[model samples]
Target: MLTELIEIIKDTFLPTIVVTGDTALKTDLALDSFEIINLIGILEDKYKIEINVIDIVSLITLEDICNYIANKKMP
Candidate 1:
């Protein structure tokens, strides 16, 4: 799941640096507000889960996003 998330982020931004769980979405990834919004939509569609705005705001690192989607997935 983490790998997939990293792939998504790379696909979205085409980052040239290595992305890790500790990488900050805003500072490390340099994701702007628009990109963040787009990411939320992408994640929702990819994971088939509704990601609320509050949840989006709470995500600080790549790991947070991976864990949130994992927890939200239907069994």
Candidate 2:
């Protein structure tokens, strides 16, 4: 799932950079405010989960996003 998310991010957001779990969504990718919002939307849609606006701030890395999705997927 993490791998798939990386592809989606690369294809949709950054094609020039290689994204890994440790990649910082802010510093590494340098995603601005709008891009971050768009990314959150894409992630929610792709993973079928709802992310609160407040939680968005906590998701600073690829690993954070992966963990959020993983936890949301738990039954």
Using lDDT, give the best candidate's number.
Answer: 2
Model 1 gets an lDDT of 0.88
lDDT of 2 by residue, 1-75 (tens): 889989988999888888899998889999998999998999888878999999999999999999988998999
Q: What clash pairs does model 1 have?
A: none
lDDT of 1 by residue, 1-75 (tens): 888888898888865779989988899888898999999999999888998897788899999988888889857
lDDT of each: 0.88, 0.90
Number of clashes recorded per candidate = 0, 0
Candidate 2: pairs in clash: none
> Ten residues in a row with the worst lDDT in model 2?
11-20
